[model samples]
Structure formats: structure tokens, C-alpha cells
Target: MKLTVVGGGSTYTPELVDGFARLRDTLPVEELVLMDPAQDRLDLVGGLARRILARQDHPGRITTTTDLDQAVDGADAVLLQLRVGGQAAREQDETWPLECGCVGQETTGAGGLAKALRTVPVVLDIADRVRRTNPHAWIIDFTNPVGIVTRALLRAGHKAVGLCNVAIGLQRKFAGLLGVEPPEVHLDHVGLNHLTWETGVRLGGPEGEDVLPGLLTRHGDRIAADLRLPRALLDRLGVVPSYYLRYYYAHDEVVRELGTKPSRAAEVAAMERELLTLYADPSLDGKPALLAERGGAYYSEAAVDLAAALLGGGGTPYQVVNTYNRGTLPFLPDDAVIEVQAAVGAKGASPLPVPSVDPLYAGLMANVTAYEDLALEAALHGGRTRVFRALLSHPLIGQYEYAEALTDRLIAHNREHLAWA
Candidate 1:
């Protein structure tokens, strides 16, 4: 089957290419298209992609282009990984929120809203184009602020599913610690994208034995260390929170730490420069080891598994994905997008039933869902008021004064991207 990657020029592309090469038996991609506006970066990444596939003796053909329509036309599945404003815009997103004494993350808080506003429109336009060219194609979104972007695509009636590496990354980690194969570990992963928790770690299947307690007893410190959270917190909560939760569980501390370090975007920019220089080497046929430090670990495996299942190919029956809640969480609106374990297939993902959620986690999920709803409104129908309201609704930035100031800073830093501004 033919597959397309919209942001194929990203430094992350080589890692994806490596997965496509290694997992050919699962996805069997025949024509892989990497589309990017940055022609120079596209050439470097595209060349490496071709070499990776050839080195593995895979028969898939790799191509690169700047034309969005050409790249998506007739593809079986199209993956969205584009950054609307590049790393420079991300730098702005990661830094300006710090001025308000808040978290400066790209996927949450005020900065996340800014990213959502900038990303949703562009992703919708691409989805529209993809639908026009190939209505049957599935849109697999790997973009940041995935919940908002995927919600926009689904609301606009596009065939789409949102993918994140967090679940897979955690699964791999848990498997290594448990001394079991990756597929043998199943996570009772639930909550919204980025903001999720592993309520249970089951083995064999969704109904298999829950080894979470044993895992905690034996490897709590290691897991807590990896998450940068306190082992006592994990013991008290009795659930493994995603690393993203740190921004919430330790907001002030995170903000203080963020203020001290260079923005993640800046570090990534430097890494990308070095990665590009490495990609320029003709002899480099594999994804560089340095790419692992660039984040999105196991992204390729997640992408491959999701795409394969969506296309009626080989993949795990149950996997974690972001899709319409459809009452998986009794408290969340059915239309709200949630990340959870689901049975994926050609028909799409249906979230598996979840046990009753504690008020602590459910309350936060409900709060963020409301914020996301407002964020989507601002993204779809731009206005200063909408921007302010979304920020004001966020649990991380609930104060009106902070919201108002952040709203102005967001628009100011992103005026060129916001059409209404």
C-alpha cells in the first residue's frame, strides 16, 4: 500500500523510515512519500530514507516533494507530522508562557493553546485536500496538540485517528523491566492525550493478569525516576502517571525549572542542525543514535502499528489511540477526544470499557476536556476573546489576569500565523 508523510523533512523522519523498513512485514508500504515545504531539509531526509530502505533490502520506493496535493494523491494512509511554524515558533511557544510564571510546554497550558490555534487550521486544510484526492484514505495524525487537531479532522468528517508514542514508549519500558516481550504487556492506559495514566499493567490481553502492583513493588523507583516524579507520589496514587503530568502535579516547580533551562525548542534546534549535518553524509544508512535523544522514541513502531491496523493489515488488536470518547468515560462528552486502549481495525478505533475513574483523575480530565473544547473554538473561529477564554479555562492558567496577558503574548508572537490577528 502507498503511504504519505506530510512533514517528511523533519529530523524525525529517518527514525520513521527505519521503522517502515524494519516492519515491512506488518505495513508493507510500497510507495512512501515525504512532503515538506523546506526543500533543502527534504532532500537530506529523503536521501537518508531511501538509503535506509535500500540497506534493509526493502522494495518500497521513497520519494520527496513540496506539493501537498501531489504527495497525498491516492495514498492509502497519510500521516501528519508537520509543524506549522517550525522550531522558531515552537521556541516562542515554549518561552513566552514562562513570562506568566506558567509551564511553557508545546502541548499544554497557554502555549498548547497557541500551538492548537496555529496547527488546527493547517491540518484541516491538508485533511480537506487529502479527502478531495482520496476520500478512502485514513489520516494518522502524529502532530502535537493531537487532541485538538484530531478533533478538528473528525468534526470536519475526515477519516482520522491520532497517534502518540507515550503509550508505546511506556509499554516498551515496562516490558523491559518485567522481562517480557513488548506485545505481552498491555497497559490500561486512559485519559486525554499527553495527560494520561496507566491504571493497570495487564499481560496476555486486556483481560489478562494485572501486574501493576507487582511492577510497583519491584520497579517503582526506576519507573518513577524515568518519569521524573517522586516514588512516593506513585505509591500514593497507585497509578503510573505519564511524564506530561509533571507539569500539573508539580506546576510551580516545573515552571521554576523551565525558567532555568534553555527552551526545549532551542535544544532541539541545535540537535536538528547536528542531525542534518549527519543526514548529509552519504554513508549514513541508518537512523543516527543521536536521533533517539531528539525524542519521539518508538514513534515509528506506533505509526506502523496504527497504520497497519487501520488498513486491515497486521497489528495488535488493542492499542492506545486518541479518538472520540463515545462514552468511554461517563463524565466526558461523547464528542470529546480521549486517549485510551481500543480495538482498532479498518472500521476505526472503539475505546475499550474503562473501570470507574477516581474523582482526582476524572476531575482533571473533565477540566482539560472543557479547556480543549474552548481551545478548538478559538482554533476554528479566531478572536481575542476566544483565545482569552480558552486560556482562562485551562487548569494550569485559571486566573483572568494571567490569561489576558498570555492571550496578548500568544497573539503577538503568532500574529503572522493567526489569520484573524
Candidate 2:
């Protein structure tokens, strides 16, 4: 099988390369293409990728290129992980939203909306090229604002599935807590991308008995601490919300904390510099340990599983992915893309039925669903009013004044990225 990574120069590529090397049997790639516009980073990352493969005795060939069409032509699958604007733009996304007293984040609130606007068009163009060059190829998106980007790809009628590390990260965490293998812990992870909750933790399979209550009883404080939430809230809610939800559950506090500390983008920029320096070393053949601090834990496993299943590579039948709701959640529109446990295969990913959602979570999901509708609208058709409306619709920035300020800030900071502006 052939695979193409569009943002092959990213610091995260080595983690993915390490996974591909270790899980070669699951997704036996014969040709792995690293396609990036940044040739310098691509050369460094590509060299490390080759060394990783050689170390593992994997025979797959590594190719690097800046030509999108050439890289994707006749490929079995294409993974989208590109940042439309680099970390410099991300720093703006992470800081400008703070001017409005909203949590500065890359994938939520005003910042996330900005990322969507900048990312969707570029991804759509690439998807168009992939479809033209290889219609049968599957598109696995690992980009931020995944819900919006995946929705754009699917709406455009591309063969696509969205991938996120959140579910896999949670599964690994839970398995460690429960003293089981990661695959043995099945999470009923549901909701839109980033905004999701682990409503159930089953063993063996999806139908296996739910052990969530027991988990909470024994490890509630630990889980709550890990999530940076209060144990009382976790106990009361009866579910574990993704860490991303901390922006919602504690909006003002998070905003205050963000204001005090440096932007996450700043920290990541420093991290990437160090990682790239490490990649430049000829002796460094394996993925650096510090890459763990860069996040996206278990990303390789998730990507390999999803890609193998999609391309008839024969892997796990059930995995967590972001796909159409298709009534998986009665509350969400069928077209709404949600992250949940799904039955994946050569046909595609189909979300599995979720247990009934509590009103507490349902209400928030519905609210965010509405905001996402507007966010997509703003992303597709750029305008100040559309931007303001999307910001106003967000639960975190519902007030008119905050929305107005955020909209202006978003347009001003993203003027170069926003064609309409």
C-alpha cells in the first residue's frame, strides 16, 4: 500500500513514522511519501523517517517532495496534517482571542474559528487534487478544527475520514489506570471533535459491561486531576469530559490563566525548534523522547488502524473516528460530524450507536452544534457579520460585546489569511 503525508515536515511526523515502523504489519506501506512546502524541514524529517524504517527492518521506501499532485497521485491514502499558517499565525490565534477575555485556544472559541477559516479552503483544494489524481484514495485528516475540515471534505464528496488522538490518548490513560492493554479498554467516546465525553468505558468490546462507575469510584480524583477538573464535578456529571472542555467548564478561570502564562503556540514554537535541531543530527535515528511532551500520544496507532481498515489492510474492526453522525446521536443532525466509536472497514467509518446522553451534556452538545453551523458558515463565506454571528453563538463568547471585539480581532490578526477581508 502507498501512503502520503501532506505536512510531512511537521515535528509530529517522526512520531507517526515511529508508529508506521513499529506497526508495519497492520499497515504494510510499500511507499511512504512526505510532501511538504518547507523543503528544509522535509529533508530533516524525511531523513529521520528513513532511518527509523531501516532500524525496524522495514522495506518501505521514503520519498519527499513539494509537489502535491505528484505525491498524492495513485496513492492508497493521503493524510492531511498541514497548518495553513505556521506557528507564527498560530501565536496570533492563541493570543488575539485573549484581547476579548475569551480562552485563547487553537481549536475552540474565536481562535479555532480562525484556524478553520484559514485551513478549510487549502484542505479543500488538496482534496480536489487527490480526487482528480486518485479517486479511490482515502483522505485521513489529522488537522485541527477537524470537525469543520472533515465536514468540508465530506460535503465536497471526497472519500475522507477524520482522525484525532484524543480517544486513543484516553484509552491508553484508562488502560494504565486499569492495568490493561490500550486496545482492551473501549471508550464510548462521543460528541463533536475536541468537545467530547467518555460516557462509558467497556472492556473486551463495545458490548462488554460498562466499568465506568467502578473506575470513578477508584480513580475519580486521579482522572479529575488529570483533566484539571474538580472531582466533585466529575462525580456529579457521571462522565469524563475531554480536557478541551476545560475551556468551557472554567472559561473565566482559563482565560485568566492564559493571560498570565505565555501562549501555548509560543511554547510549541520553542519545542519545535529544539525538535527540528534534534532531527538535524545524523546520529538521531529514532524518535526523540521529548516528542512525547509535544503531545498526540498514540497517534500512530490510531492512524494505522484507521488507514488499514479503510484500505483493506485487515486491522481492528472498531475504532474511534470522526464521521457523519447518521443518527448515532439522536440529538445531532445526521450530517453533523462527531467523534465516537465506529465500525470501520473498506466501505468507510460508520459511527456506532451511543448510549442515551444526559441532558447536561446534550444541551452543551446541541449548543456547540449550532455554533459549529455558524462557524462553518463563516469559514465558507467570510464576512464581518458572519464572523460576529459565529462568535456570538459560541457558548464561551455569547455576549454581543465580546463577540464584536473577537470578530474584529480575528479579522485584523488574520487579514492575510482571510481573502475576503
Candidate 3:
């Protein structure tokens, strides 16, 4: 099978390449295309991708191009991992929101809305091109604000499923803690993308015994530390929230802390520079361990599993993915995209039934779903008022004054990306 990676110039490409190389038995790629506009980074990352494949003795031929059409044409599946304005823009997304006394995060709050405005239009255009060239290809989106982007793709009638490493990362961590393989650990991962909670962790199979309580009892401190949340909160919630929840659960404290440190984008920018330098070296064939610090942990495994399942090849039949809720959570609109365990196959991913959520989590999910509706409206139909309304709907920016100020800052900083601005 042939596969395409749209944002192939990203420093994260090698980690993906490494996964394709290591998991050849699952996907068996024949040709891999890396498409990006950034030529220098593309060359560096592409060279490393080739080296990685060769080292693993994978038969797949690697190709690099700046042309989107060429990269996606005749592909079996396409993965979207692009950053619309790159990390420099992300730095702005992660900083300017702080000026409004809000948490400066890339995928939540006003910053996330800014990213959605910048990204959705570009992704839709790319999806249009992909459909024209290869209507049969599945678009696996790994982009941020995935729920919004995936909703856009589905609304526009594209065959797409949103992918995130958070579910897989947590799954792997749980597996390690349980001394089992990653696939054997099924997470009851639910909620919108980035904003999710692990209500259950089952072993052996989806219906297997729940091991979450045991994990919490044994490793709550470590897990809480990893999520940067208090252990007490985990005990009270009786579940683990994704690390992204840190921005919400501890908004003020996080804002205070963000004020004392460089934005994550800045840290990642520096890391990407070093990673690129490493990629430039002809001797580097394997993905560096430092890439772990770059985030998206176990992304390759998730991508491979999802791709293989979607392509109807041999792989895990069930995994956690972001797809239409379809009433799994009756509180959410059926059209709303949610991340949860699903039975993935050639027919596409169908979410498994979730046990009813606690009011504590369900209330937040409902609120965020409403915000997502407004956010997508703003993304699809650009207007300052739409943007303002979207921000106002967000729980994190519910105050009209903060919403108004953030709307202005978002438009001002992203004038070039926002056509209406």
C-alpha cells in the first residue's frame, strides 16, 4: 500500500518513519511520500526517513516532494500532520493568550481557536485536492484541534478519521505498568480530542477486567506528575484526565507558571533545531531518543494501527480514535466528533458503547461540545462576530470581556491567516 504524509517536513516525521519501518508486518507500505512546503526541513527529514527505512530493510521506496498533488495522488492513506503557521505562529498562539490572563495552550481556549481558523481552511483545501486525486484514500488527520479539523473534513464529505497520540501514549503507559503489550491494554478513552479522560483501563480485551484502580493505587503519584495534576484530584475524579486537561483544571496556576517560563513552542522550536541538525547527519538512521521529549509519544504505533485497520489489512481490529460520537454519549450531538474506543475496519471506525459518564465529566463534555460547535462555525464561516461568539462559548473564556479581547488579539496576530481579518 502507498501512504502520504502531508506535513512530512516536521521533525516528528522520523518517529513516524521509524514506526512504519518497525511495524512493516502490519501495514506493509510499498511507497511512502513525504510532502511539505519547507524544502530545507523536508530534505533533512526525508533523508532521515529514507535512512530509517533502509536500516530496517523495509522494501518500501521513499519519496519527498513539495507538491501536495504528487504526494497524495494514488495513495492508500494520507496522514495530516501539518502546522498551519509553523512553530513561530504557535509561539504566538502560546503567548498572546496569556496577555488576556488565560492559559496559553496550543490546542485549547483562544489559542486553539486561532489555530483552528488558520488550519481548517488549509486542511479543507488539501482534502479537496486529495479527493480529486484519490477519492478512495483515507485521510488520517494528526493535526491539533483534531475534533474541529476532522469535523470539517467529514462535513465536506471526505473520508477521514482524526488521530491523536494521547490515547496511544496513555495506553502504552498503562501497558507498561501492567506488564502487558500495548494492544492488550484498552483505554476507556472518551471526550473531545485533547480534552479526554481515561475512565477505565481494561486488560486482555475491551471487556476484560478493569485495571485502572490498581494502576492508580500503584502509580497514581507518577501518573499525576506526568499529567502535572495533583494526586488528590485523580483520587477524587477516580479517573485520569489527559495532560491537556492541566490547562483547564489548573488554569490560573498554569497561567501563573506559564508566566514564569518560556512558551512550550519556544522550547519545541529549540528542540526542533537540534533534531534537524541530527537529521542532517548521514550517519543517523534511527530515531533519536530525544524525540521522546518532543511529545506525541507512541504516535507511530497509533498511526500504524489506525492506518492498517482503516485499509482493511491485518492489524488490531479495535483501538481508540476520534470519530463521530453517534450517540455513544447521548448528551453529545451525534455529529460531534469524539475520541473513544472503536471497532475500526474497512467500513470505517464505529465507536464502542461507553458506560454512562459521571455528571462531573459529562457536564464538561457537553459544554466543550457546544464550544466546538461555535468554534467550527467560526472556522468554516469567517467573521469577527463568529470568532467572538466562539470564544465566549468556551468555558475557559466564558467572560464576554476576555472573549472580546482575545478575539481582537487572535485576529490581530493572525491577520495573514484569517482572510476576513
Candidate 4:
């Protein structure tokens, strides 16, 4: 199977490439294609990936190209991972809204809307090209504002999937806290992206042995003992939350007892700065150790080794993201295609649905839903007014007047960023 990575020039390509190389023995992959607008970086990563594959004695040929047609032709799956303006712009996405009194988590609200405005057109163009090239290929999107971009792709009637690991990652983390094996735990969740709440949780043992009552009885008292979350949530809501722990839990009664919200931007900014510093720190050595440390962190391995699964009657129990509601998920709009779980095979994919989210999460997500939806409107019309409306509608924007002012300033600030219609 020919597997193509559309944004092969990403700085994280090395880690992702290592992931693919690690899967050499487990998955049946034949060719690895690196496609990007930046041929120079692709050539560099492509050369290195080929070397790594050969050194491992695996047999997938590596090819790098700037031509979308040349790179994606006859491919089984396409991994879409790109940044329109990199982390600098990402910082702007996050910080600008925080300055405006909005919750700025880098992936929601005005930040997300800004990103969607810039990225949607480029991604849809890729999707359209995929239609003409690999008509039957599965597009696995690993980009941010994934919900927005995937929504747009589905609206345009393309085969695309959004993939975010937060849900599964949360499940596993909670299982660890519960001292149970991962697959043995059952949870009910809903909402979009990082905004979600778990409604029910059951620890599986023998069928009749309900672990929930006993387990919570013994250690449930420790739940959020020092954290902002209420320990009674274990008794009340019935499930542990999976995402937005930092923020949602921050609102627990005890924390809210402080009166006003404390800004954690410095803390969050420090983390981002540290990572950027490390990525840019050329003088730092131990490349091998660093590679090993980050190798498995982002699940790049799962991405790297997908070629064989697509062609050889072998199916990896991994998720292939697509943008289509078509009834696969009951919680989201039917026309939407979220990056939910799915099995990839020669025939294509089938998305699996989980339970709907709680009312709290649904309300939280309602804030961003309009922002996400409006970005699609902006993309389709090249409408600056729509973009303004999206930004104005964010939960953190304080007032519509402020939203309009911010939009006006942003338009003046990012004048060259958009090609106004």
C-alpha cells in the first residue's frame, strides 16, 4: 500500500517517521510518500526516513514531492497535518483572545476561528485534489481545529476524517487512577473536542460484581480532594471527566470560592515557550535520547505504519478519521464527521459512535459551535464579516462591542493574511 503524508515538511516529521519505522514488522506497508509545498524539507525528511527504513531492513520505498498529484496518486491513506503559519501564528491565536478576556486554550473560540479561516481553503483544496487523484482514499486529518476543518470537508462532500486522541487518552488516564485495566472500564461522554463531560463510568469485573459502589466507597473520597473538582462528583455525576481537566475542574466549588478567576496564561505560556526553546535550541545535544523520549509521545508510530493495513487484508484496530455525520455519531450533528474511532481496511472505513455528552459540556461547547460553524461560512464566502461574527460570538469575548473592535483590529493586523473577496 502507498501511504502519503501530505504535510511532510512538519518539524515533527522525524518523530512521526520514527513511528512508521517502528511499525515495519507489524504492518504490511510497501511505499511511503512525503508530499508538501516545501520540497527542501520533504527531501531531507524523506531521505532520512528511507535510510531509517533500510537500516531496519524493511522494504518500503520513500519518495518526496511538491506535486500533490504525484505524491497522492494510488495511495491508500492520506495523513493531513499542516500548520498554515506555524507556532508563531498559533501563539497569536491563543494570546489575542486571552487578552480579550476569553478562555484561550489555543484550540477553541477566536483562536480556532482564526486558524480555521486560514486553513480551511488550503485543506479543502487538498481534499478536492484527492477527489480527482485518489478518489477512494481515506483522508486522516491530524490538524487542529479539526472539528472545524472536518466539518467544512463534510459540507463540501469530501471523504475526510478528524482524529484527536484526547478522548481515548482521557479514558486511559482515568483507568490508571482507578487501578483497572483500560479495556475493562466503561464510560459515557459527549461534547466537541476538548470540551466534554463523562456522564457514567463503570468498572468491569465479573458481571454481577459492580465495582462502582465498592470502588467509590473505598477511595472515591480522594477524588479532587485538593483539586478544584468536587469529590461528590463521583457520587453525583457518576463518571470522571476526561478533558479540560485544568479548566473545568478549576471551577469546582472550593476553587470558585476564591471569587475571581486567576489567569494561568503565564504558566501555559511558559510551557509553550519551553517547548519552542527546546525545538529551536541547536546547541542542545543527545539527539538520540530526545528522539527516544518523544518517539512514542504523540502516537506517531500509529501514523507511520498504516500502509500495510490499507492493502494487505490486515486491519489495524486504529481510527481513520473522516468528515461525515451520516449517523455514525449520535451526539454531534448528523452532517458532521468527527475524528471518532474507526477501523481501516481495503474497502474504506466505518465510524463508531459513543454515548452523548452531559448537559454541562453541551453548554460549554455551544460557545464554540457557532465559532466553528461560522468559520466554515467565512471559508465558503471569503467573508470577512463572517469571520468577525465568529470571533464576536466566542464565550470569552465579553461583549459584542468588544468583539467587533477586536475583529476590526485583527483585520487591520492580519491584512496580508487573507485574500479578501
Candidate 5:
């Protein structure tokens, strides 16, 4: 099978390449294309990708290009990981929101709205190009604001699925704590992308015995520590919320913490520089250890599994993915995209039935879904009013004054990217 990576020049590409090399039997890629507009970075990342494949003695051929159509033409699948405005824009996304005394994050609050607006249009254009070239090809989006972007692709009638590393990362962590293989631990993961909870941890499969209570009884503190949440909160909620939830559960505290520390974008920019320098070394054949600190833990494994299943190859039958809800949760609209465990195959992902959600979580999910609706509107049809409404609707920035301020800041910082600005 042929695969294309649109943002193959990203520092994250090496981790993906490493997975493709190790999991060749699962995906069996015949050709792997890395497409990026940044020619210099693409060359560095592409060279490392080739070396990684060759070092593993994989039979797949790796190619690099700057042309989007050339990279995607006739591919079996296309993975979107592009950043519309790069790290500099991300720095602004992470910075300006805090000025409103709100959480500064890339996938939630005002910052996430900015990312959604900047990303959706670009992703839609790319999806349109892919459809024109290879109508049968599947689009796997790994980009930030995945829910919004995936919604855009699906709404535009593209064959697409969204992938995130959060579920896989948590699975690996839980497995280590339970002394079992990652595949042996099945999470009852539900909710929207980046805003999800592990309601249960089954031992063998989706129908296997739920061991969540036992896990909490034994490793609650450790898991809570990893999530940067209080152990008492986990015990009370009786579910493990994704780390991103910290922005909600402790909004003021998180904003204070964010104000004190350097933006994550700044740190990542520095790491990318070092990573690029390392990639230039001809002797470096494996993904550098520093890449792990760069984040997207276990991204490759998740991508491989999702791609394999979508292409009718060998992959885990049930995995966590973002797709149309289709009434998996009674509280959410059927068209709302949610992250949950599903039986994935060539047909697409179908979210498994989830137990009744506690109002606490369900209420938040509903609220965010509404905000996402407005966010997509602004993304599709840009205007200051749409932007302000999205910010006003977000639970994190519900106040009129804060929403107005954030809307202005978002537009000012992203005027170049927003055509209507």
C-alpha cells in the first residue's frame, strides 16, 4: 500500500517513521511519501526517514517532495499533520489567551478556537485535492483541533478518520501499572477529542471484566500524579480524565501556572532546533530520545493501527478514534465528532455503546460540542461576530468581557492567517 504524510518535515515525523519501520508487517507499505512546503526541514526529516527504514531492512521505499498533488496522487492513505502557521503562531495561540485570565492551551479555550480557524480551511483544501487525485484514499488527520478538522473533512464528504495519541499513551501507562501488555488493557474511553475520560479499564476486551475500581484502589495516586490532578478528585469522580481536563478542573490555577512558565511552543521550538541538528547527523539511524520529550507519545503506534484497520490490513479490532458520534452518547448530536473506543475496519469507525454518562461529564461534553459548532462556523465563514460568539460560548471564557477581549486578541495575532480579518 502507498501512504502520504502531508507534514512529513515536522520533527514528529521520525517517530512515525520508526513505527512504520517496526510495524511493516502490519501495514506493509510499498511507498511512503513525505510532503512538506519547508524544503530544508523536509530534506533533513526525509533523510532520517530513509535511514530508519534502511536500518530496519524494511522493503518500503521512502520519497520526499514539496508538491502536494504529487505526494498524494494515487496513495492508499494521506495523513494530515501540518501546522498552518508553524510554532510561531502556536506561541501566539498559547500566549494571548492567558491575557484574558483564561487557560492558554492549543486545543481548548480561545487558543483552540484560533487553531481551529487557521487549520480547518487548509485541511479542507488539502482534502479536496486528495479526493480529486485518489477518491478511494482515506484521510487520517493527526493535526491539532482534530475534532474540528475531522468534522470539516467529513462534512465535505471526504473519506477521513481522526487519530490522537492520548488514548494510546494512557493505555501504555495503565498497562505498565497493571503489569500487562498495552493491547491487553482496553479503555472505556469516551468524550470529545482532548476532552475525554477513561470510564472503565477492561482486562481482555470491551466485554472483558471491568478492573477500573481495582486499578483506582491500587494505583490512584500514581495515575493522578501523572495527570497532574489530585488523587482525591479521581476517587470522587471515579474516572480518569485526560490531562487536558486540568485546564477545566483547575482553570484559574492552570492559568496562573501558564503565566509563570514559558509557553510550550517556545520549549518545542528549542527542541526542534536541537532535533534538526541531530537529524543532520548521517550516523543517526533511529529516532532520537529527545523526540519523546517533544511529545506525541506513541503517535506512531496509533497511526499504524488506524491506517492498517482503515486499509483492511492487520490492526487492533477495537481502538480509540475520533469519528461521527452516531448516537453513541445520547447527550451528543449524531453529527458531533467524539473520541471513543470503536470497532474499526475498512468501512470506517463505529463508536461502541457507552454507559450512561454522569451529568458532570456529559454536561461539559455538551457544552464543548456547542462551542465546537460555533468554532467550525467561524472557521468556515470567517467574521469577527462568529469569532466572538465562539469565544463567548466556550465554558472557559463565557464572560462577555473576556470573550470580546479574547476575540480581538485572536484576530490581531492571527490577522495574516484569517482572510476576513
Candidate 6:
């Protein structure tokens, strides 16, 4: 099988490629086509892939290219992990809104709309390329504005699935907090990207959601009693906690009441990094860090593992995927894409349907859902109206006049950055 990895410049490429390498025996990835706008970094990642393949005793083709058409041709799957602009662009997303009273944030609020505006065309262009070159290719999207892009792809009739590891990993954390084995826990979630809520948390099949709230109600205080919630936790968050639960705690009442955002998930990642540093040092007491993992391939390991599992017919693995709502999200717009649990298999991904979400959770999401809709419209129209509407309707950015003023400022400040006025 061949995999086309877009956005090879990601720091995570090391694990991503290594993940594929580990699955070599099962998938035997014959080709790895690494595409990136930055050719130098693409070359760097390609070199790492070569070293990984060399040591793995598996011979395969590794191609690095900036030519979009060449990179996507005939690939079984394409992993989309691109950014519209890097950290500088991200800083603008936060700081421009900070000029208003609106909280400076990423992935949600006016900043995310601005980002979606910039990124949608890029993602659409890539999707078009995949359509022309690899009609059968499955786009497993890791790009931000995931719901927007996924909807665009589906509306345009392309095969795509929006994926983030947060749900897979977040549910596991909740299970741990509830003092249950990880495998015993199951989650049902819906809503816009980085702005979702758990409608149901349970054990076993359809029966667990009923007991989850009560279990959490009784056990949650015990979990929170020892773990102090700090404000600076965003500094070290591992994978953005399913969606934007961090921001939810800060703004959304349902999330605050659920007591999840205060879980200090970032502290866990940060503390783990600290321990890793200690373990990796020569004078450290813990186990030695494996030298083979110093390369880039390890970064792609989970991605490749998941890919291989799907292709190899591993058990029905549930994934948090962004897909066309189609009925999975009962309250949200029908055409819009929402991220939720999906059962993945050889056939493909099926979005898991949960009983309707909570009124408070649904109410909180309605505002953000409008943000996603307006962002999509803005991307399509390239005008101020859609952006303004999205901004005016956001929950966190409730100050409409202030939001409008911020919009005008951002447009003026980012004239060079925006493709159009």
C-alpha cells in the first residue's frame, strides 16, 4: 500500500512515519509520498523515512515532492496535516481578537473563522488534486477547521474523513478518572470542531450513558479534590483534548459543570515530558530512551497503526472522526460536519449515533455551530458578511459591536495576509 502524507513539515512527522514503519509487516507500505509546501523540510522528513526503512529491513519507495499532482496519484490513503500559516499566523488568530474584549483563542471564535477562510481554499485545492489523481484515495483529515473542510469535501463529492486523536485519548482519561478500566468506557459526542461535548459516557454498548453522570457526580469530587486546576494549562496540552475542552472550561457552563476542563490534562503531558527528559539523560535512573526512535518515522506510528488496523481488518475500532452530519448530530445543521465517534473498518468509517445531546450542551454548541457555518460561508464567498455573522454569533465573543470592531481591525491589520478583502 502507498500513503500520501501531506504536511510533512509537522514536528510530529517523526512519530507518524515511525508508526507506519512499525506496521510494516502488516501493511507493507510500498511507497511513502511526502508532500509539503516547504521542500527543505519535506526533504528532511524523507531522509528520516529512508533511514527508518533501511533499518526495518523493508524496501519501499519514498518520494518527496512539492508537486501536488505527483504526490497524490494512486495513493490508497492521504493524511492531511497541514497548517494555513505557522505559528505567526496562529499568533495573529489570538492577538487580533484580544484587541477586543473577546478572549484570544485558536480553532474557535473569530480567529478560527479567519483561519478557516485562509485554509479552506488550500484544503479544497488539495482535495481537487486528489480527485484528479487518486479518485479512490481516502482523505483522513488532520487539518484544523476539520468540520468545515470535511463538509466541503463531501459537498463537492469527495471521500474524506476528519480525524483527531483527542477523542480516542480523551475518553481513556475520563475512564481513568472514574476508576474504570479503559476498555470498559465508551463515549458519545457531537458538535463543531474543538467545540464539542460528551452527550453520553458509559460502559458496554448502549446502556452506559445513563450511569455515567451519576458515577461522575459521586466520583468527580474525589478526582478533583487532589488535582488543582491551574489557568496556564494550555502551555503544555498534548493534543488539544478531543476538541477545545480547555476553552470550554473557561467559557462554556456545561463543560465547567462537567468538571473536565479543569482535569489538568496538559499537566499530565508536561509532567510526562519532564519525566521523559529525566529518563533520556545518561545520569537518569529510569530506562534508556531507544536510539532508533530519534528519527522521524516514530512520529507517524499511531497514524500508521490506525491505518494498518483499518486496512488489516482489525476489530471494530472506534475513532473520533469529523464527517457529514447526515443524522449523527440531531440538533446541529443537517449538512454540516461534526466530530464524533466513528466505527472504522475495511468497509470505511461510520459515524456513531448517540441519543440526542443534553439541552445545555446543545445550547452551548448552537452558538459555535453558527460560527462553523459562517466560516464556511466566508470561505466560499470571501467577504465580510459571513465573517461578521459568525463573529457576532459566537458565545465567548458575545459583544457583537466589539466583535465587529475587532473584525474591521483584523481585516485592516491582515490585508497582506488575507487573500482578498
Which one is best on lDDT? Answer: 1
As for TM-score, the candidate ahead, 4 or 5, is 5
Reference-based lDDT, residue 391, model 4: 72
| RMSD per model, one decimal | 0.6, 0.8, 0.9, 5.4, 0.6, 7.1
Q: In candidate 1, what residue range of length 10 has the lowest lDDT sum?
A: 105-114
Candidate with better lDDT, 1 vs 3: 1
Q: Give Cα distance to truth, residue 212, candidate 5, Å.
A: 0.8
State the TM-score for model 4: 0.76
Work out the TM-score per prediction.
Answer: 0.99, 0.99, 0.99, 0.76, 0.99, 0.78
Clashing pairs in 2: none
Indicate the TM-score of model 1. 0.99
lDDT tens readout by residue for model 4, 264-362: 434444543444344444433222344533212444644542344445445354443444555654544676544444555555456555556556655
Query: In candidate 3, what are the lDDT values of residues 101-160, reduced to their tens digit?
Result: 998888999999999999999999999999999999999999989999999999899999
Writing each residue's lDDT as its tens digit, candidate 1 over 148-264 gives 999999999999999999999999999999999999999999999999999999999999999999999999999999889999999999999999999999999999999998999
How does model 3 fare in lDDT? 0.93
lDDT of each: 0.96, 0.92, 0.93, 0.61, 0.95, 0.65
- Model 5: colliding residue pairs: none
With candidate 2 superimposed using the best TM-score fit, by how many Å does residue 371's alpha carbon deviate from the native?
Answer: 1.2
* Candidate 4 Cα errors over 4 Å, as ranges: 171-189, 198-237, 245-296, 301-312, 316-323, 327-332, 338-357
Q: Which residue ranges in model 6 land beyond 4 Å of their true spot? A: 25-27, 55-61, 174-184, 203-243, 252-302, 305-315
Task: Please give the distance, in angstroms, between residue 129's alpha carbon in candidate 2 and its true position after superposition.
Answer: 0.6
Q: Lowest summed-lDDT stretch of 10 residues in model 4? A: 286-295
Q: Better model by TM-score, 3 or 6?
A: 3
